[model samples]
Target: MSGHSHWANIQHKKGAADNKRGKVFSKLARYIMIAAKNGGGDPAMNLPLRYAIEKARSVSMPKDNIERAVKKGCGENGGVTFDEIAYEGFGPGGSAIFVDILTDNRSRTNGEVRKIFEKGGGNMGGPGCTAHMFDRKGLLQVPALAVDEDALMELALEAGADDVERLGDLFEIRCDPTAFQAVRDALAKANLSTTMAEMTRLPKDPMDVDAEMGRKIIRLLEALDDHDDVQSVYTNAKVTEEMMGS
Candidate 1:
């Protein structure tokens, strides 16, 4: 598994996702509101809002909460304004790291994020430094037992997927961001169920690190992920299975 994917599976195994379900919902709500606010309240006319709504629905976020967020974004309930921001930095082993944030207070968020990087033995960099090292892609993970590899590969490729890779007990479907919805819809039409689906940044060249450095990087990633204002964190550090075990 890729480092980020492994870490996500670890979090799921640790029950962190379930434990922090409320926080997850809140983050999803913020994403929906921002999308709606930027592109208008109509999901049909708003790509970002549609993606946000689908992500929320996949996680079983309450319908009422989703609707409320859309309304708030449309200025129906005097919603709080938020700004989307990105932070770049280097973690252990000089591995590049990128963070996506949504916050009402830029200064406060900047201070807090900077402290996190400093505390994690990292230094912040100017914008675009690390962003250039990654590409945004639509990723879907389906359990191996749920679909035949040959069938899925053929189906996904025909449905506009870039590749279907077998990673341990899961099959990862990757595609361009523009084809994300279409690929997903195609899989659904074929009655394939995915365990995880989302559009995320993938490192173009993952940098390998020693176990010690890997641990340090994981610490920094986790710390950043725990912050309420942080929506996502991407890193070029690759963690081996042995390092993960250690």
Candidate 2:
């Protein structure tokens, strides 16, 4: 765990993601709506809806809120339509930043994101700028002490994971995006708990940066993530726990 793994763990410990629960719920609702509208309101028939519902439920989102979003998506309740967009850019030390966005107002979000990048010591780029540098995959985070490494690896690999990596006190399980749910179900059957699980873009090349530059890169990531429309942000800047003051 160097860039994303380290940063995610640190953020989890800091309660950074949970601190903005209201914003999280709203973003998740948008995710559900889009998934439902694209496919159908039934999770059994819609894979994306199932994933979205699971994520919302993971965060303890109210059942009524989820139902209403489903209704809105199915045209029972009027609501704003959102577009899925990806923003690619460069942060301090030439580190790559990839942002996943869901928004009803593209023009407004575009302007705000550009300013965020500039203010955080970075610059926004056109499509395929930094996006080509990453591969979309499923990543699962687990504490080292939670399970035996060899046993966990065997189970994950048997269930379709590409590999299991041991990084300090953390374990990262990487798998093909399509196999994510299978691997997750396998772990659950074995009574294992994961701290974080998501399909994300992983950097092809991790960039080494000094502490000062790393700090700048993280600030840019934080700012982008704080935005209402930004759902997720990925980076390639390599920094240590001590350097990030984790």
Candidate 3:
């Protein structure tokens, strides 16, 4: 979690910017559709759908769009069926990269993803190449202004959270995947709101790189993220603001 929270914060700011371009809604729709496809249309009985809907609402995704996505997933409204894939790769300075994709056409998405990797000083690898370097966990990011640190820590701990730490202006609470919903429910009952909440892969160890190498990795990452088929991009690159600036 050393470098993850910082990167999550960066992504949060970047997502706000991306939202204006409608990219955020597209991504949210994909999440909702996939969640629905996997776990039925009712969010109440589907934790993934519940979380996906919550995230979509956080970004102000249209109610109609959400309903359409759910209908599409449930096959009530005809739409292209999406398949999820995780691609592994390496970026500058041996940084491990993981890409989560939801696509109707795997061949096209794979080709495009491979091309981006090649052009960005990286190369796609066989599945599980970099996946082994990460751990899947529940991450909840709460704003610093939302609650007292000591009190939040106690709440989270009592709720079965794995750990709670401050990441810049936010407090990041980590919990096991099994306890994610419970922890979230506890927070909600306490009237604590989260800035971001998701189940994500956390790198075991972040790779530190020089400014030039970090910049190259960042460019590769952003390029991968901009692809329409790409849902989420994770990397072990530990790049600082100064490194990004320089």
Q: Which candidate gets the maximum lDDT versus the true structure?
A: 3
- Which has the better lDDT: candidate 2, or candidate 3? 3
For candidate 1, give the lDDT: 0.84
* Model 2 lowest lDDT segment of ten: 10-19
* 18 Cα displacement, candidate 2 (Å): 3.5
lDDT of 3 by residue, 1-246 (tens): 567644555666677789899998998899899999999999999989998998888888889999999988887778548999999999877889999999989999999999999999999999899999887889998899989999999999998999999887889999889989889999999999888888887788877787899888888888998999888888877876665544
Rank ordering of all candidates by TM-score, starting from the highest: 3, 1, 2
What would the per-residue lDDT of candidate 1 be over residues 72-164, giving only the tens digit for each residue? Answer: 888889975999999999988798999999999999999999999999999899999999998898888888998899999998998899889
TM-score for each prediction?
A: 0.91, 0.90, 0.95
What does candidate 3 score on TM?
0.95
Tell me the tens digit of each residue's lDDT in model 2 across 1-246: 345456555544433355355777887888899899999899999988998898788777899999999988887778548899999899887888899999999999999999999998899999999988887888887889999999999999999998899887778998889899999999889888887777777777778888888877887887888898988888877755566543
Superposed Cα deviation of residue 106, candidate 3 (Å):
0.8
lDDT of each: 0.84, 0.82, 0.86
